[model samples]
Target: MRKRALDTVFALAQQDERVVYIGSDVGQGTLQGFQESIPERFFVEAISEAYVIGMAAGMAMTGFVPYVNTIATFLTRRCLDQIAVDLCIGNHPVRLVANGGGLVYAPLGPTHEAIEDIALMRCLPNMTVLVPCDAEEMERAVRASLDWSGPIYIRIARGGESVVSLPERGFFIGKAIEVRQGEKLLIATTGVMLQTALEVQDIMARAGYNLGIVHFHTVKPLDTAWLANQLGPYSHVASLEEHSVIGGLGSALAEWLCENGDHKLKRFGIPDRFADRFGNQAKLLSYFGLDAASIAKELQAWVKPS
Candidate 1:
């Protein structure tokens, strides 16, 4: 997904002269093609994340769409003030292409995890938080991001994710995708959780419970209209994400559902604590009860399997 996103930035630059690439300590080979092809527009800076946001803001003001690439934690945690002041305040068209979102760097410990990044990016007034489900969706988001107004935060997941999204459903910045429809339960997921939701859906199916899925790639502009309509038939609704339970897709749904509906939402995500263990992404996911088996077990506690 990271490759697809960065490669798409170069593809966009090829078509639009206004597009520029900015990398922050992402190694020399990062976006190498873009740097070689458009050396004048490519910039590889040091570990100055705040400076990157300010630079992108300035470039945006000059009518250039600057796409900044870096780790998710640094992009949000280290540069929140700059992002809010320089990008969100001015409503620049700078694209924050964040890599290793939501624990992709779990082997590196909590410091590398972007568990709270969604909340940080979502709080900004003009910042649009987008978490694509896979590489294809990431590519689509990149292309769709070319014209969207305001600062956009594109969350990139680990590579080699499942392909649950389809071109037929189409890609829109604010619209959610309906992966499947069910009668008993509806599982709303964002980013890499779509595939896990699908696995859980099938798990519940074997136990005689029907489950539906709504892929919420866009978290900021919650697709309330479509989501509101989709929840009517299901007896249960839930949100599954790879981010922290707070201030992410789960919290966003709670804020909207609390006022508008009576459905009790079951949120499945990382708890409100920092990660202390070290392992691969899959190990961390299993340890956090985000794997399909564990998620299904939790779901069964609420709704009887059979």
Candidate 2:
């Protein structure tokens, strides 16, 4: 997804001179083709995330659409002030293309993990938060966001995520897509967890229970009207995300449910505390009960009472 977004940025810059790429100490050869093709518009500055954001804001002020790229934690946890004051407050058309969202860097530890990035970005006004599930969807989101006003926080995994998103659903910035239908349980998720949710859907189907899948690539500015309609048919709901349970998709749905309806909501995500041990992303997901089998077990246990 990260590769596709940057590639799309280059593709967009080809037609529109306003589109530019900015990065803060990313890996070698990250966008070499982009830099070679458009040397003036491309930038791979020093490892200063905050400074990069401030610079991007200045560039945006001058009518240049800067797509700022960096590690997710550095972009959000380290550069929140610049992002809020420079971009969100000014309503700049900057795209914060974050890498290593969630536990993609589990091998690197908690400091690198971006479990609270959604909580940080969504709280800011004039910031459009997006977490596209696949490479195809990343292209769609990046292309669609060109004309949109204000800053956009696009959280993406390292690379090679499952290609689960469909073009037939018709991607939108602030809308939810109902990917699959079910009878009783509804799994509302975001990011790469859509693949886990889809697997859990099939698992439950094999167990003689039908579960639906709804993908929310756009976390903030959530499709509330669409969500309200979806909850009526299912007896229970599960919000699966690669973020914290405190202020992610679960919290967003909980806020809507507070004043609107009386529905059962089960939030499937990382606990409030940081990770203690680590391996690969799959290991961490299993530890958090976010894998397909663990999620299936949770669904069975969560729905057995009703």
Best by TM-score: 1
Pairs of colliding residues, candidate 1: none
Tens-place lDDT per residue, model 1, 1-306, is 999999999999999999999999897698887887899999988889999899999999999999999999999999999999999888999999998999899999998899999999999999999999999999999999999989999999999998888999889989999999887678999999999999998889988887889999999888998877778777678899999999999999999888988887999999999998998999998999999999998888887543
Q: Candidate 2, after superposition: displacement of residue 251 in Å?
A: 0.5
Stretches off by above 4 angstroms in model 1 are none
Q: Distance from true position, residue 184, model 2, in Å?
A: 2.2
- TM-score of every candidate: 0.98, 0.97
Q: Tens-digit lDDT track for model 2 on 37-107? A: 99999999998888999999999999999999989999999999999999999899999999999999999
